[model samples]
Target chain A: MGLSLKTAVAIIEAALARGHELRLAPLTVAVLDAGGHLVALQREDNSGILRVEIASGKAWGALGMGIGSRELGERATKVPHFFNALAAASQGRLVPVAGGVLVRDASGIIGAVGISGDTSDNDEACALAGIAAAGLVGQTGARPAEA
Target chain B: MGLSLKTAVAIIEAALARGHELRLAPLTVAVLDAGGHLVALQREDNSGILRVEIASGKAWGALGMGIGSRELGERATKVPHFFNALAAASQGRLVPVAGGVLVRDASGIIGAVGISGDTSDNDEACALAGIAAAGLVGQTGARPAEA
Candidate 1:
């Protein structure tokens, strides 16, 4: 099933609230359904004009690659040229960073959340917090522990 | 000054309310600042995947051309080749149609709103209703009355 607007708004609100509690800069949040289409977006006042695109790119990249942006970032370092080309292929929508996280449920991934306006790690933390607050599992694309 | 997130959200809510009263199809609304940057956007559940981009394109065209998209449509009829080239140059962001309306106040043009998922005329009507509900002026870019 697709992500509902109500659920998307809840994620954005909780993410913003978490950012506020952490005293981060003004943040922008974008929620994208599994199809990588925008369901909702909010750009805080005084945020950069490009923040909407940036936030959406992060989540879109995660959804497109079937992995969180953190893992994408890790891969980018090993294959910089390929990632650069991928960015061009996606019309600059693929942002390999840490702030894009996938939302999961028993059925599978339903959507993703992307945040901007702080350290990438901090942004991802907020995303995870928001996902948890909404009672959804967040897949951060971290490497699994080896035996 | 730029439009605040609160004001943008209010416009979207009121526009959706209008659409609901009229029983229109699922709708998408986008608000863009004078710089043609998205401030906020929402795509209702079951709306087409491209609804967000279509809505954003309409509002972005209005902001970029400094006129509501209704006027852009009229102008496009007179210069089909030019309009086609303009659309190409804007990377498909320019949508000349009736649903895009400019938001204004005593200070001047601040932003534009675009709606989709109904007849263009009906979409424009909803946009006007929303702007009025928010206590703002709406410019439909209609032809001026001749003296």
Candidate 2:
């Protein structure tokens, strides 16, 4: 089943709360449905305008690949040349880093949540918080539920 | 005083190289002049179809505002409600996140690069790589020389 918009919002809200508690810098959060369509997006004021896109891109990548952005980053490190070339080939729509988590319900992959405006590790933490708040698991594996 | 097409291409090339090295999935890359004009675009064969638009949006936001997309992301956090409304108002053209970098030459703001397909953090890394490849600094607060 596809990720519900309501669930996506809940995830975002929960993540924001944690960010606030941590006094993390302004953050941008985006949730993409299984189909990769944007279900919800929130950009905090004082956060750079680009955070919205960054958050969305990460989530989009995760939903599209059924994996975490962190995995993509690790891969990029191995083949720097090819990854750089692909960056040019994609026309500026590929990001492979942490801070994005795939959303899953009992059935299967539902959607994804991406966070920006903090360190990569911190971004991932916020994303995990969002997923946990939704009462779902944020997992990493060879075959994640596809969007 | 603007981002030359050649430099833009080089930036994309470097970004892709990084992606492949890490075995990250396909990606899309986009570069924009300080005026937010398209300079170069690329999409890998395996990249998702939506990456193109996402990349463009991030670059556009960066170039339009003359700042790193990451900075924009922070601003969005303070005024999340307004930011959300603005995202809707922009009709998907505005991303406002950290995956985009403002390109700067000795003269000044030349262009911005945006990369998608991986994660927002990965996208930002690739964008930074492209900036370095172009022999320019991706500064947060700089106006375009041409402007």
Identify the leading candidate in terms of lDDT: 1
Tens-place lDDT digits, model 2, residues B1-147: 567788888888988888887777788999887667788999999888888888888887775444667777887674343234334434556677778788776765677788788878877877777677767887543333233
User: How does residue B17 of candidate 2 score in lDDT?
Assistant: 89
Q: Score the docking of each candidate (DockQ).
A: 0.82, 0.04
What tens digits encode model 1's per-residue C-alpha lDDT throughout A65-135? 99999899899999999999999999999899989999887778899899888899998999989888888
List the candidates' TM-scores in order: 0.94, 0.52
Chain B TM-scores per candidate, in order, are 0.94, 0.86
Candidate 2 local distance difference test against the native: 0.73
lDDT of 1 by residue, B11-96 (tens): 99999999999999999999888788888888899989988988898898888788889999999999999989989999999999
lDDT of each: 0.88, 0.73
How would you class the docking of model 2?
A: incorrect
In model 2, the runs with Cα more than 4 Å from the true position are A85-91, A140-147, B1-147
